[model samples]
Target: MEDQPEHSVSNEKSTAVGERQLHRGDYGAETELQRHLSTRHVTMIALGSSIGMGLWLGSGKSLASGGPVGIFLGYILAGSMVWAVSHSIGELAVLYPLPSAFVQWTGKFVSPSAAFSLGWAYWFNYILTVANEIQVTSVVMGFWTDDLPNAAWITIFWAVVTLANVFGVKVFGEIEVVGASIKFGWIIVVIFSLIVTSAGGAPGHGPIGFRYWNSDPFTHGFKGFLSVMPTCIFAMAGSENCGLVAAETRNPRRSVPRAVGSIWLRLSLFYILGAMMVTINVDPHNKDLFGQSGTNASPFVIAYREARLPALAHMMNAVILISVVTTGTIYIYSGSRNILGLAHLGMAPKQFKHADDSGRPWPGLVLSIILGGGLAYLNVKNSSADVFSWLSNMTSLFTLFGWGMICLAHIRFRHAWHAQGRSDSDLPWKSWTYPYSAWWGLIWCMVLIVVEFYLAVWPLGLPPSAKNFFSNYVSVIAIVVLYLGARTYYRGPWWIKLTDIDLDANRRFYVDTEIEKVPEKGLRGKAEKVLGFLFN
Candidate 1:
């Protein structure tokens, strides 16, 4: 947070000079952010961000509110939204390869005021996510014992994440690759365990073949289904962080597309199918599904506990702890870069843009730690489940709003491309679904936001609570205030004209370089290709 820059009038020509003047002051000439992340590193970063606590801990609430069928549908709808937004972001990032990703694009393609809202909104989203990850990590630890306080565990992992991010992008990327690989393997184990236990393969369980669904498919009916949308949105929040790191990757043109391409597989295998298995093995109406102590909240753990498999339950909890801590590291890495991007665009203080020789934005990193890490102390005063509920609600709302803006920015970019007489063949990587996918993402995201509004007003089986209403809708209110305040201070237009949009700034790096493709030839090559296909 820095003071707003004073607005100034400029010419309305199609030249770079006019465009740069219209978008705050000229873009900062120096950007010391290094491109150190490899293809594998970037791919797993995307995977690691999305495959964390939302599925492990928060799914209990989803299943409790909406039964088996309701939660399944929620995952499908939310997965589709993530897919559409991923392609939109992929196409834009490959073309622009800029420092801030879609946040800066809103200023260039839409308006400066919109970019101001997006940049700060996205930064805050990650900050809240940081706290959410920490709280959940403590909850996961409860599965073992409550020997130490949640606050003690919070401080320990906070230091771990902070140290990981402080060393620069290379260190962070390496850690993510390892952490994400472990998580990937653990999910496969969980899915297989669920399959086995559901078929009566465990010691003391009868066959569980859709028995829960037969009893009650939809727990609370249509309203209950609507209530799960926000949690679904929260579950998929970090998938977009892949494209945001384009500026820090070694070869964004190749790495970003690979990362984006694999998102569909991740969603289908990890989220959608994972939901199906959870509902099959664990009863949605079980009282253990609503545990507030976090010890028995995860349906996956509950399923194993009921099946007489304590050892497996313990193993699953251990991996969940690792996954939560890994996610915390990602939020800090992404949050710092977001603020750095804001500074580069002249939307924040110049000092925030400062980077060390190793390309670490120390100032922004410190601020992220203070604000995001500080929020974890809320668990000291309230139950872990209560803290998780409100934090997830707030973060999910912000994510849905940010996603809608991303799709809008993409649509506007296409308009500007055609208006400037640019050919589609000149593009390095094209979004196969173009206008249709962008529209799909935009409309559905808006609908989900509206669903969030409805659920906030009347929570599942309870009257409207002032605390609940604000906890869920505060993200919407904050963004509106940020947008109006920036717009008033800058005296900018509501939207940029298509003909005057700046489509060429910071794009020469991607447009001028030829895409080099290496052919696969030997055993090593084949092995590498298989790994790339699976991860990248």
Candidate 2:
């Protein structure tokens, strides 16, 4: 599979864009994606992908481990790293805008083995995450009914999402937009209320100020801070999906950069400001409030409780449940697409290559649903409520691994581009601080992986309940084994041959540049451009 070439490059001429004509078969595919997704859909989808259960439930764990300062710094560091990775992906997405952006790019720019390993790794990661998200949804629902087994809710939710995807991609996009809108709305309300309450409003609690951090500035100290970095990084991990969906967006050349550029704003508003609000409003040392029985004591919830707004806590919980469901839907969609990409490339079973008349990969969607539902059921039976926690941590390792691979691939891609004498202007979106940003992301991911490995093994200051010190490392180990096995079987050396990397050579097969347009000037044109910016 690694050695197989998906397409052959020919010098025929076909298709015109405005005034320019593309070489015949510029993009590898014969069919073009319909531009059904608008800018709002794309932006919200990106936002939704990054701000799910992690921010709601996982933040408490990070705070418990690292305390306030730890959680704050971990997010800052990780957010910066993710920003770099996102930019790298954005650059590639704009240039190619293929269905399976990352996997396809890896196959073309690095080695087929690299692409195969990455595709499987990312697919497996999302599958596990979907299982985890469903489990979280069940747990949250249990707050209302403990008698109903989580597995039942898991199956129901999985079925609903499966049916949604089978209908068409547009359904998925619309659902994501609505889901994200709810979550984003809830966040805005929470943030606004927190600020208002902190400034001495509502009943009682006179100008709360930063009294929460007075006694224990750093709850767990340096050890705690180091421990929380992994989870913090996980929260910001999937923002690059904006680029992944670039192929489905209209005018990706402009849309992709706009999406990528939004990362900084999101980090500032969502991660940094959100974390700050939680830390300043809720004390990390509130042991009784955030202990084991209080697993659902998200820092956000804790803040509301502190302000004597118990009702808001319930509302937040409901919002969180919806967030989990929305996130699961997105995960399944992405996982199925990854599988479809693999099938198209001859790496996965051809059954996954089956697409409906509307271009939705029904076979892959069904497979993802069945697998996700089965995993959810098995996890419920074995681990019960703890399934989501376990799967979430395990998936974090793979997320880091995926980010690291992207950075490395971009580094190689830039080198190859320079070697081929291609200028940056020829690219749709260019990543700034070449090599530096990519290297920073790679290094941070490596560091976090090592630290996570140590935490999983030593346990050190961690709670004794944390099990299987090596479980989180399983994904990393699996990736290594696959790469080595593929390398040995292919009779290839450990080093990759850069020139042999296809890097979108097949993309020329389907890219219809004639349909693509350059932005126009004036108010009406600018308004259209602004609207176009939202889809991806």
Candidate 3:
């Protein structure tokens, strides 16, 4: 890729502003992302990001905690929150498509310090996520090979992902597409089989319609449902990554809106329906089975085994492994890109701007691999998975924080648009219900954050478990300390002025006319169209 003028920063001003401003590199006129990320890749990324081992491994916990009713309602609540957040992100993405996306927008609407805190928090969250996924892959691998140490497996997996990333973004996207296809296909089969078996088509069982329900329909009650909200939110976390890639998308204006609009349907069909199938097939009260199975236990696997298809368990495990790897790879890719964006904005070291012939951020990718691998090694050395749990919980917090920032950014972006006397139609993508959707998403995120802190800090009369309490609270505390430390060093006041925010700097690279295609009529039309369909 030819290096553009906007990609280079001036060296003369580097020393004048001091290291902090120097680190906040220029928000260039152009971003160094490839347009190779097509609509299918983008959509598949969003799908794959949300549908991970979490669904397979974590769903049982959610079901056990909330029962059928809690599982259903918790997912619905979290899914709706994700939907609104996706829409809010879409609006900002259309208006100002940047690589950092929400973080950059937050900086523009809030403060540089706010952006700094939010950006690093998110980057750290993804790093921890990348580490957690590595451990998860190791755990899954150990199911087949008990001899190999998990640390060794994690190191090997990290190296493979790092190599894939170094090859280029296109290669990374392609691998993810293939990985996503396997996971998505497996889920479809599982869902179908579930429906068939529930209808009593199996030879021995007959129809098992709601049999598990009568056993313990409301097992966990309200608290159980609330308890599982963190995992549910984690599953739905990546629904908005589409907006993050808008700057690199062929037609972001059109594609992002289309992708955002589909969040509701996807969540309903993929998550809600999939969870319901598990609930119908497996009894949540079967603590004995769960205890024996542990993390290797997928309700779908259990159901398949019970239905005389024990081999399906192996297939599902393989698919889950692939899903974890894919998600881990994407997290590393995203984390590196976030670092590159930060580098470009002078928020990080300038070395991160080093891109190869394929425009891959080499330095950023290397750093992520090192960080991810190091974290994995640390977890193994500690002989405690509690660090992983704590990191995962903190990730949930940061993810919520990022979502809240997106809504706040959208609100400010709209106000700026109105202040400039631009009509809503003038924008490339418009969010329905205006400020209300944005406000609702923001409020919901704030509520989740508060609740997460509460759950982390106080037991609310639950058993006095040190592991449970610290695992929950440490993340929140760590993030606050990091944010405050960064702000203090920068000499920034707690409150940031909105006028100082640079909302429009990174938006100049977007080409609005590229994504004007209308929605296709039938299935054939939709199938025939490629990347453009994402926008439609």
Candidate 4:
């Protein structure tokens, strides 16, 4: 990744450049990351990150508030918007395939102030989230013993996940692949178990099928549905990490879309349907379903026990412990890459973008650890339940805004791409549903967020509490504050015109146009093509 002389991208050339190595990026001078993550790496990362504490722990909130049916509806609806956003970001990300996905694009496509807001907002969102995940790990471990203090467990997990991220992208990818695969397989098993247990197939139960669903499909009605949204929002928030890893991924144009395209199907089967299974098997009135009992309180675990599988429930609890740590490791890396992206935009100091010999973002990782790792210590004095509640309210809406920004920026980028006389097919991955799809995602994400906010802060409903009001709406206030602050400090135009964007800036130094088009002449080629289509 030594400096290969910088070259400008040709405007007349097509946007779809096929699979290629990434040496330079649209990010400023510090684009020395080693492109090593494969399609499986990113796909699993997308899958694994989404299946974190949200499903393992937060499902309690979704079920307790929304009940089975309401929570399922919430996930499916929110997931649809995220699905559109995935395609939107995939199309734009392949253009530059840089770290932090939609972050730097705002500067060139929208305005400098806007880009600053998106970049820092995304960075803080993940970094702080990583800290919260670590705190939850200490709480999850408490399922086994209270012998060790929360601080000790927090320190241990903080160091382990930090090293995993700093070890390099390859190491990070391998961990996620294994962790996510296990989680996926476990979900499938849990689904089967739920079906069986509900059918009176287990030892103690006698055909509980549809009993819970028929009795209490909607817990708190419409307001309850809104309450579960933050949990669903947090569950669906991590898919964008696929795009954030673009700069360090091989053949992003192919890998990113391949990963992004699968998000909806995964959510349908894993999240929405998984919750449906819990509804069929577990009683909505169960106190443990609220996640107050830590790992033991997980609906998945309780579902296993309902089937007379206590040992299996405990084992799944152990698996959840590993999944939490794995996800925390990935977010730490992702957050740092975002910081590196900011440096590339010259929005932050150059040191944050520095890379070591293995293409590890040393400075960025250190900063993430300093901030995220330090914040994890909050679990020492406060309870994990309280910390999780605060973190959830603060961050639930943040990444939704990130997705909205991606759609908005993509709308602008598409207009500019067409205005320059470029056909949609010329792009590596044109969002076929473009303009309409992006608008659909952008508008709904905003509307749902507004409605959810009102549900939380509304005077009549929900228990009156400062935590409810502040935690839920603080992110909105923070975004406005950051935008105004950036606008004042940067003092730039409100929006950059489509024609003026430096499309030529930071084009990858390497390109292989024949990546997907290579002929399948030999048997080896045919197998490779099939595998490529499956993964690439």
Total clashing pairs for each candidate: 0, 18, 11, 2
TM-score of 4: 0.89
> TM-score winner among the candidates?
1
RMSD (Å) of each candidate, 1 decimal: 4.3, 6.9, 6.1, 7.2
Q: What lDDT tens digits, residue by residue, belong to model 3 across residues 33-58?
A: 66667666676776677677567766
Model 2 segments more than 4 A misplaced: 1-35, 145-147, 204-207, 287-291, 378-385, 460-467, 493-495, 500-504, 508-536
Query: Which sequence of candidate numbers ranks them by TM-score, best first?
Result: 1, 4, 3, 2
Per-residue lDDT of candidate 2, residues 280-374 (tens digit): 77767665233234545567876776778889878987888778788888888788777877776656787876676776777777778878767
Of models 2 and 4, which has the larger lDDT? Answer: 4
Clashes of 4: 2
Candidate 4 C-alpha lDDT tens digits along 69-137: 888888888788878888887887777777666887776677777878888888888877888788888
How displaced is residue 87 in candidate 4, in Å? 0.4
Off by over 4 Å in 1: 1-30, 290-294, 508-528
lDDT of 1 at 168: 81
In candidate 3, what residue range of length 10 has the lowest lDDT sum?
A: 14-23
